[model samples]
Target chain A: MSSLFNDDSLKSIAEAYEKYEKELVPEWLKKLPERMEEFNTLSWIPVKRIYTPLDIKDHDYMEKLGFPGEYPFTRGIHATMYRARLWTMRMFSGFGGPEETNQRLLFLIKHGETGLSLAFDYPTLIGIDPDDPMAEGEVGIVGVSVPTIIDMDIIFRNIDMSTVTTNMTINPPAPVLLSFYVAVAESKGVPRHKIGGTTQNDPLKEFIAQKSYVFPPEPAVKVAMDLIEWSIKNIPKWNPISISGYHIREAGSTAVQELAFTIADGIEYVRQLTARGLDVDEFAPRLSFFWDSHINFFEEIAKFRAARRMWAKIMRDWFGARKKRSLWMRFHTQTAGVSLMAQQPWINIVRTAIEALAAVLGGTQSLHTNSFDEPFRVPSEFAAKIALRTQQIIAYETGVVDTIDPCGGSYFVEWLTDEIEERAWKYIDRIERMGGMLEAVKKGFPQREIAEASYRFQQEVDAGKRVIVGVNMFVEEEEEDIRKVPLLEFNQEEIEERQKQRVKRIRSERDKARWSTALSNLKRAASRGENIMPYVLEAVKAKATIGEIMGALKEVYGVYVEPPIY
Target chain B: MSSLQSISEEIKAKRPLKVLVAKLGIDGHDRGAKVIARALKDAGFEVVYTGIRQTPEQVVMSAIQEDVDVIGISILSGAHIHHVKKLMEKLKEIGADDIPVVVGGTIPLVDIEPLKKMGVKEVFLPGSSLKTIIETVRRLAIEKREKEKLLT
Candidate 1:
């Protein structure tokens, strides 16, 4: 690498900086007193008032950041980026039963949502049928309940499975849900290879952040790999795993931690898949990521830029991946739900817009801007529409999409990107030294880190160090006194009763002999260390309920009991 | 004996105020529950937190086994009405009805009254300060102890 500045020139510049600081700073300080405060990023990275070439003096332009679409794509993965095509506005939508969720999906589609993201209810997420005793009140509460193949069919009833890409935010039971999607697509005459979307078959993050895990870590990851292996052969268009850092950030880890832990989990997944005799290039291209666009505007942008660069290095240098596509780190960004406040709900709109803009500047491939009212309940229709419009305004009106990585050459952005990447790499190194993410998780390293970060943040908020508009500073005397925000109401008892009846009907209506045979085959395959995907697909086709399939697997793999961390 | 001495004696004789912190139903979002657990622990309460996706029956059974002074249920999945109501019924069925239940999470304003009517002693919605939650739990624990003494 050619040096940007010679030794004498650099020394001259350093001397000049020292002279300026010594002479000019004192004069300026006397005339204009500086604000008496410590400045830092939301993640607590110290910030200086001004950034210059001195801050990035060590930056090797061609090595640290290359041309967009080149190796180590710090600028962006694609050369043209949004100039060629805008990022997909994939709004995450789901609530009540499949029918209701289907309507929401269509509503988003009608409002120019380019892609669909499905959020399964608690019962579905944890691999339980709606009628299960444990699933009683939770049915269709948080997300749509998909208990059987029929429910999945209803959810995607008229939507063309081949045309629209879908993303399912699910794990642990991801394979079962993916099997149902396949069954739905096949029944719709869509070819298996033509089916597209991603299932969040990331079990490691579930242990780290989201606690919707079913089996033990080893077996759960085995199941995730099973889906990845199956997707490589059959569903070429499908991304089998979306290694998620979104939930990690929501669970209160700093941006660097989210990046590192998520990448480490990706590394663990890659290791497991390669150990199963799969080629790195074959499965690597299908590996995608999910990230959170938190309120820290510049920090979030830097985090995303750093993520792409780090991922490229890991894939090419570490994993020896040769495919350029394999080296590209494609991710979906969701605005941080934890940043939304229930106090001044309307202010959340501004927060979401800023977060979404950061994601755009960060070069996300897909984005989901969270609704303002999400802190209270499921977003009302008006709120969801406004959230979608937030993205539209950024894309069409803001002109941010006109350029490719507009912030690429900014000194502050580049410096922050390097800093975040360095910190994240250190975390990755620590995890690697601990024998990787699984061991780290087993020792509750990430969990305790997240808990501590969460507690510290709460303390900051409570102590008035951090200002949350209406939460701590401008406190609302009474809810009624504030602007009336409409709440999304769902008839819980009605939804639950209808879901239970549907499950019961499906149980009675399906060919019991076929269901039993398929379930037995699944249980046998799960027990004998065979690939469980084919059997799971067969069971789904046989109309086996999610709980039944998960129950059989649970009998084999056993449930995970998380070690108490906090 | 002096009142302070008698109070200290009572506190020494009694077990620490045990609070069962639980997430009932399928909501895997337990950041609130976990935060509350840590805060209560810091405030000198022994908190037994059941991890996410716990059924109401499981929560009630655990509460009974732990013999908790308070049952703090955190539900962000928007099923608080159904879940908390069923939990209240389950506690009644098990005859552990004396335990005061405090609910927290993103509860709707309209549902707050109904949740309280379902025997939830307090409802802490989103943006509820940690100090507020801690103070509420402490006050509720004392009220429960006094009521138990009267019943005895």
Candidate 2:
């Protein structure tokens, strides 16, 4: 590579690397428009038309884009994006037995990961013991299996619970896991207010995508609110919910749809909690977001910027959240998994780096970059380390973080932010007209919308209108061979047998009479429309396993039968 | 029932064989499975989606229920070797081993040899062409049915 900055003559050419319009002047005008029509991102935001001041024409900068850490925090979340401190470089790490996952956490922390995110296996998410027949052959495979409080104890074993921020990505059993965390914290003598973390507790999107939910929608929302109310009072530092649009994006939503639907879900949660008389600021400050970062460079950057602007406006105007923290849009970004193809999986590294750049440019508080080998299976250690190093390179070497919102003034970015905001609001209004996100989800509007968007994007790809480097165009004739390794090794049978032993031990050792008393108290609380968290804590202290507590609640709430998503 | 026969006949006429895709076991990573389902559907076969998390008994019962000529199993959670072998054994137990089975997803290239040895007709992996899968399933189903007819 030539030193462009050193030579004045090369600067113009280097700058024109992106300015194709300058090359295609009067002679090219006729051919350029038609050529422009051929290549576009999946979101279909055309290159030239994607950005401009006209996109944000109607907006008042002072009103909508106030200084960061102030009302209407569009510029940056905390006034000083990285000047104060760099964004939390958190890693979403978890797997195998709880002890194993804990060891991995320590390894990641050693490697300069600042915060934590947990990915529990299916059994933990669905409130089943690891030994349940439904949990067969899946123990510690996809994510770590947290069966009981013992598992949680093992997960956080020897880690400083009070200082480290742990985000648990479990929706259906979020409350169960959160309760177990609290119980474990109490055992560790950490004050509840000092423990900080966020749970993926948005159940509305569970119905929309990432279908790992248990319980009916209504009961699920109620359970989510129970956590919200309890967390507002006790876990002051904890974000009770992280409403996710990442899954929606992964499930094939357009960028606009992901923004709209995620904000709509946030609206419904606030409405539900506000209806319950909890102050918005008390809990709203803890509302976090998760978005998917993909290869559509500027569009995603625009999407994130627009999201902050939109969320800031919504909180200020609608909810009356006066606190600066309550109005900020703090989010974690993961590179889009759908963008990873099993073919030429090595190429995923470049794709991830590009996506991660979009995230940093768009102002992500934390990020999880997918490993190149992920589309085949869970990333191997070499792959995960590379994935982690990619982020480290971006943070340490890249100058992008030095300037907050580097794309803030780019005509393309500003135009995109405006376009996304306008379309997303229109979508939110449509959802509102249809009675809200939950009802729309039940009626399959959001699901169908995503499917339609995905289908249309594929149609564009098939027609050669969209260029997906390896998939549709610039194709390689031959593929390199992929070496195989053992998928995550775990003694599934042994874990279950030990769990059975633990069950027997707990059943035999715990005060059966006191357990029954606490169990009845939980059952009564569930049925009497009382806050079940208090009773859950009581039962937790009684050594009631997750199954027992959830079983008692199930007796009242009844198991949910999901009406099939068409 | 009439639509089923019509669809199957249309499939058999257009291609060379008809295959029914069914999910067996309580595994729910159906994004890939569903995409394949759509691909197979477009390839002119009667794809019977058993939805998320169905048991082996349910899979065989659905094959019987739909009168699906062939069964395609997609297992991704490292349970393919056991699940496919167990399902085939149960098909024999339930007197339906005459139905041919093909497996797919996350099968290591080496494990592919072992799976084939255990009587899986073939293993279609990730990036396998939807067209090839359709053609292969058709050929395998016809061959298996002819062999069964001779045995009877």
DockQ of each: 0.61, 0.29
Interface RMSD of 1: 1.7
For each candidate, the alpha-carbon lDDT, in order, equals 0.90, 0.76
Docking class of 2: acceptable
Report the lDDT tens digits of candidate 1 across residue range A198-301. 99999999999998999999999999999999998999999999999999999999998999999999999999999999999999999999999999899999
- Model 2 lDDT tens row, A1-566: 21212345345545654365455454567665555544455576556633334434455666655666766566778778876677676777766678778887888787777888897765666777766676666666567777667778888887899899989998867777888899899899998889898898999998787777677788889988998899889888988899999999987789999999999999999899999998888878889999999788888998998899889888889999888777888998999987876666678889999999999888889899887766555666667777788888998898888877777767667767777888899999999999998899888888788866765665555566666667667666665534443234556567556656665677679878888898899899889888788888778777777777778888888876544332
**Stretches of model 1 off by over 4 angstroms after superposition:** A2-16, A23-36, A481-483, B1-16, B93-95, B148-152
Clashing pairs in 2: A52-A415
Expressed as tens digits, the lDDT of each residue in B13-92 for candidate 1 is 57778899998877778788888999999888999998877788999999999889899999888888888889999999
TM-score of 1: 0.95
Error of 1 at B41 (Å): 1.9
